[model samples]
Target: RKLPGAAGAADEGAADAIRELEEQLEQATQSLRAREEESKAAEKRGQALNSKLRRAQAALAQARAEARRHAEAGAHQDQELRDQVASLSSELDRARRKLKRAGKRHEEDKADKAARKELQEDFERRGTELYKMNDKLREAVERADLLGKALAMQADEVEQLRKHVGEADEWRAKCDRLSMAEAAAAVG
Candidate 1:
């Protein structure tokens, strides 16, 4: 009975150690699975960020190309404008020289034109003088009319003076009759 009891106890202890070792192994396997999931998520995020960087680089290259094209077009336009300005300047210089020669010929014509202008001015001055003389004649006619009216007034005043002299003679005769009557009364 003793030998059987000892052998049964040894078997029970070995079974408990085996059960503990199995629990530890299951815990380690769960931890390894969680770490694998985290690694996969990190890899996906890295790929997305790399794709965004590539897109940004491509857009930057396109913008640079557009800027270069604009610069080249502007340079060509500026060169064309410069060439046009140069040609216009040369044409202007030629026109100025031709105008100077025409001006020299115009100077020769100016002497004849100046003589004609002087004759026209003399005629204008004579016409102005005639107009002034006509104005003076009109004023003289007005003065003659005024003098004729004054002479007519003087003639009317002379007739009034003659009437006044006749009235004075009549008054003198009446005064003489009154004086004779007064003398007769005194004598009687």
Candidate 2:
């Protein structure tokens, strides 16, 4: 009876050891599967970050290109505006000088106005005197025309008187001849 009891106790101890070894193997398998899942998640996160970095770099390059083009255009417009301002400033200066000269001339003309007025009045007075002289000369020419007509009539009267004198002389000579003839007849 004692030998059988000892043999039975030994068999029970060996069964307990086999059960403990199986539990240990199961725990190790569960731990290895959880580590594999964590590694896969880390790889996916890295891939997503790389894609975002590429997109950001492309956006930055595009923005730089646009900025450069705007700066160049702005510079060109600024230069054009500056040139226009310079041209307008020069024109304004020229206009101002011309106005100043004109103002000086106007002041000089105003100062001489009294002398100019006196000369104008004298010229008008002389013109009136000359007009009266011209009227007198016209009247003298009319009187000369009348006198010339009277002289022509006097010359015609003188010519008629000379013809009458010649006729009288002829008659006187005939009378003298007749008287002499009569005296000779009486003597005979």
Candidate No. with top lDDT: 1
Off by over 4 Å in 2: 1-107
Tens digit of lDDT per residue, candidate 2, span 30-62? 543454454445445445544544554455455
Residues 46-153 of candidate 1 have per-residue lDDT tens digits of: 455455545544554555555455556555655665665566557555655675677875754554456456546755665565566555545555554555555455
TM-scores, each model vs. reference: 0.45, 0.39
Q: Model 1 reaches what TM-score against the true structure? A: 0.45
Question: Which candidate's TM-score is highest?
Answer: 1
Q: Which ten residues in a row have the lowest lDDT in candidate 1?
A: 179-188
- For candidate 2, give the lDDT of residue 25: 42
True-structure RMSD for candidate 2 = 77.6
Give the total clashing residue pairs for model 2.
0
